[model samples]
Target: MSTARKHDPISVQDYLAGEAHSDQRHEYIAGVVYAQAGGTNRHNAIATNATVALANQLRGTGCRAFNSDTKVRIRNAAGTRFYYPDAMVVCRANPPSDSFQDEPVLIVEVISETTRRIDEGEKREAYLEIPSLAGYVLVEQSSLSAVVYQRGRQSGGDQGFQRSIVSGLDDVIQIDEIPLELTLRELYEDVELAEPDSTDRS
Candidate 1:
């Protein structure tokens, strides 16, 4: 899914150069570049709350939490793709000091109505290609629910991602990539959510 801006297929180098100076963020898929859409206040709040919580927990630890500014380079069946996740965690001893992280252990994306399918379908499939990635989280903005795809410990290789949907304010998401836990309360702290509708149960 693309927003208002899109460009003819460009080289990775050109994309990188342009993105460095561009005020807006863009994702490079193969050669085509797509502009990132702006988030709502609720979306921004969720991302910020998650980042702050993760960052504070990761302090003094080798693992680090990164906000949307950091790009994640992914290699998937489709091709080379670069995405800016809502928040991510990297645990490499000496991760590349480049504009992106190629080895993120966990990737989190806050989904809106427009990007819901992309986050849960296309993005989830692509993110699992990262060998170091053990978890991919999708947070819903319209409701208090989350979907998680976590790699199974006993699974042979990169082929064992298990999906689970978590709901309600009291639920907690146990991250397999890092030794950290995220509660729905912590993720949505300070943000006022709408009341759930009786017909909205899914």
Candidate 2:
């Protein structure tokens, strides 16, 4: 996402300062800040459902669930960057007092038409760079599909990740990061998903 700049490149400090009081939220990349788009009712509901499910299961487990308001920092070739995931679970018993979290086990995003590319591509790569992150989930708003990318260890001693595409309501995720099992039904509960287009294939 290319953020328009009015003058000289702004510092990260300035971006954080502006984000503190700004009515709207923005993502800081390198030295530029890009305004985040507003989410629809469906988007918000999906995020809320995921958060609630996570929170209920994580109660007294020492893990905490954070909503979109919390930012996550990542260091990459592009330098330090910050993003706001729709839902995140940090396993740290005692995290820092900063407004953002640096080590999250799971990072979730409810995909929208406007941000599909960035979420699935750029953000996906960035999230994987985090050693503490175990998985990155992308929930589709227009359908009952969710994709999960999780770190896995092969028998050959190679370390990488595996990707799973879950669609049916019966499909459930058994992640190693948390003690809870997340099902598609729990995520889409009490919410209406956007109908697929007539020409949609698979």
Candidate 3:
């Protein structure tokens, strides 16, 4: 996503209003709006696969899975922000009149080269602050791997999250909060992963 250049800060009300009529989607950070760029075929496929899987499993469970078009509203001491996660599951449905969801049980972000930083850092931090959020997942488009952060007690006996790394197509992500388990093969179905760069070393 690219930051809107030379744009003045706008209020949350104004941003929401503008977004309703705008052709493209933008993420609101405090008073600034960042224009979201289109994703690659692989990115779209992964997101769709995850959403479909979740939706299928959540049937008759009183929970709903939302696609990227739906926004997740974040309100904290810093300010109000709205973000479009790749896919999200909300057990407590928001009112039909509401355009954004305030309580998502699970939030998924399909990470790409351009969005890796923000998705893993800023967005992860913000999403974890939500009391209703039980898990935050970051899926990689370049590989069959995912990083999951599940709400749990820390080693220090304080409420926090536990990070788990899931790799390989045989692996699966199990979230007891949503009572769902998704395997890597299912999430990457028909999606062609990008070739790794030989020169890059992490």
Candidate 4:
């Protein structure tokens, strides 16, 4: 993401108004707006696979899965920010007119070379502040792997989070929060991955 403007801080109301009529999507961080870059073929495939899998499993359960077009709003001491996650699951429905969701049970982000820093650092930090978020997932575009952060039951806040890694196509990620399981094979389906580098060991 790159800064869209360099002017003084803009109000959330003004940002929303501009977004409604804008041709491109931008993520709002506090008062600054950052233009979102288009995803690669693999990025789009992975995001679509996850969204479709979640949406299918969530049917008739009152929970809905959303694609990158939907924004997740986070407000905390770090200030108000709006991010477009690759995929998200919201158990509680938002109003029909709302453009963003404040309460999401699960959030997924497909990370690439350009987005790895913000997706794993700033975005992760801001998302952990949401009391309603039960799980945050970072999917790697370069390989068949994922890093999941689940909120521990023993405590609250960021300290109560537990991180786990799931790698390989045969592994499955069990999201107990939403009671759903996703396999790496399904997530990487139709996506072309790079060949692993072979090391010379004598």
lDDT of 2 by residue, 1-202 (tens): 3355532468878877888998978888887687776777878888999999999988999888999989998878888888989999998733565778888988989886656778888899999888888888998878888999888755775276689998978898667756557888989997787765322111
| lDDT per residue (tens digit) for residues 23-75 in model 3 | 98888998889888887677888999999989998899999999999999999
Q: Candidate 1: misplaced stretches above 4 Å?
A: 1-5, 93-97, 155-159, 194-202
Residue-wise C-alpha lDDT for candidate 1, range 31-82, written one tens digit per residue: 8898886776777888999899889989998899999989988876677889
Give the per-residue lDDT digits (tens) of candidate 4, residues 10-85: 8899989988898888889889888887776777889999999999989998899999989999988768899999
Question: Global lDDT of each model?
Answer: 0.82, 0.80, 0.87, 0.84
Model 1 clash count equals 0
Name the lDDT value of residue 43 in candidate 4: 77
Clashing pairs in 1: none
Give me candidate 1's TM-score against the actual structure.
0.89
Q: Residue pairs in steric clash, candidate 2?
A: none
Q: Which stretches of candidate 4 lie above 4 Å from their native place?
A: 4-7, 154-159, 194-202
Model 4, residue 39: distance off in Å is: 0.8
TM-scores of all candidate predictions against the true structure:
0.89, 0.89, 0.92, 0.91
Quote the positional error of residue 11 for candidate 4 in Å.
0.4
